[model samples]
Target: ALALYVNHRVRVPGTADIVYWLADEWDGKGIFLQDADALVYPYENLKKVCEHINEKLPFVERIAVYATAADVLRRTPEELAELKRLKLGIIYMGLESGDNEVLKRVRKGITAEEMIRAGKMMKNAGIRSSVMVILGLGGSELSERHARETIRVLNEMDPDYVGALTLLFTEGTPIADDYKNGRFHPISEFESLKELLSMVEGSDFTDCFFSSMHASNYLPLRGRLPAEKERMIRQLKTVIEKADQTLLRPESYRRL
Candidate 1:
């Protein structure tokens, strides 16, 4: 993929690093920003970098900046005003499983209260945000909280987009280690689908774009919420109930 993606005709230096790209500074030394989420960058700094780049050759047809796990650590709600000051239009976040216990077990480094504050901060900043969740992070140990608390978080922030990614244990991470050592156990494929469906079963955010279509998920699904969510949930459930272990998402999908 790397060889194929490198275009000789293209002179762009940086492949894809939001921090560098924001500054019109793209170096090839791209480190996959993976520390739960990218919510840590200060909005003021982000906005300054973004505004500077757009001044010359605008790289955006439509402006959309994501701050995944905004509710986790990257930044706090108080810093959202900086985004508007810089004229940013979009913010994306991953509330990746609302269960507090699950978050603790995974060592995500943040709490439910902080997550709520972070989301509200994004909304107040006038930067539209997308909130995501992991369907199977809790597994059997936290099944009840997994479904209940997720809804609780969603109810609070009610982001512009609510997405879901079924948990996929990547290589050598703490979560993966837990899985190997029996310290952590995620839901079975079928149960995961159930958790996903149940978490958003009666969600009030009708306008949020819901996507479970990423490569990491068992079911690649997408739709608007409140209305189609039920049908979408049921459809996913059907697949999980029917398919065997072979139906699981390919482990290779997780690289980081």
Candidate 2:
């Protein structure tokens, strides 16, 4: 069962209350919720909760939900349709990297193939996917491979929205330990920009919005893919040519 908590906040004229909840169990993808169980609410129970919400607060415009690609893949077309019917706009997917080697090293527990299938499933069911990829996830060793592979995956998935965030390490995580032991080498600012440039330049999307405006990113960029591809690449190229540290976000200011 999912627990709901109501926060009285106004974003519109009427009461713009936001209902928040944690899933009874969630599919583990990475360090975040790594051990979470893959449990889903019963349809009847889910519907009843929505009915209760509708009765109590009728002004809510969106209900946000987080799920892994595997979770989305597990959903039947009917279930996905029902979720759309319930007004769930976009499902947040943290696709850390599209490189299979990086994925295995990180223990993501799902494959690029699964992500592609899941993304298509959402589109077929009239649901939108907002997928995110980590910029330095493949580290220095596989930076180029990461970017190219990510482009490959995104081209196939063709997500409605794509987010690019640079990797941020916490002290105790496995990846952090790897870094400490010299097993993993973090990419430099220029290298990260190179990867980002390659990703945007290589990707071929059918009308999708791409952004690297996350705080962790050294350079922030947002534009429509393919259409604004040249513009974005030019901007990256300018910064790359300048090689100005002032043009990039400082390491001290970067965060998760």
> Candidate 1's residue-wise lDDT over 19-113, tens digit each?
33344453332222334433455556555665664553253323455454533345544555654554556666667777778888877767777
lDDT of each: 0.66, 0.79
True-structure RMSD, every candidate: 6.7, 7.3
Q: Write one digit per residue (lDDT tens) for candidate 2, span 1-256.
A: 1122233322333422331112213221111212332215555665565555555545545545568887777678887787667655567787888899999999999999898998899888777788999999999899889898988998999988999999999999999999999999999998899999999889899989999999999999999988999999999999999999999998998974
Q: State the lDDT at 182 in candidate 2.
A: 96
Q: Assess candidate 1 and give its lDDT.
A: 0.66
The most accurate candidate by TM-score is 2
* Alpha carbon lDDT at 8, candidate 2: 39
Clashes of 1: 3
TM-score of every candidate:
0.72, 0.82
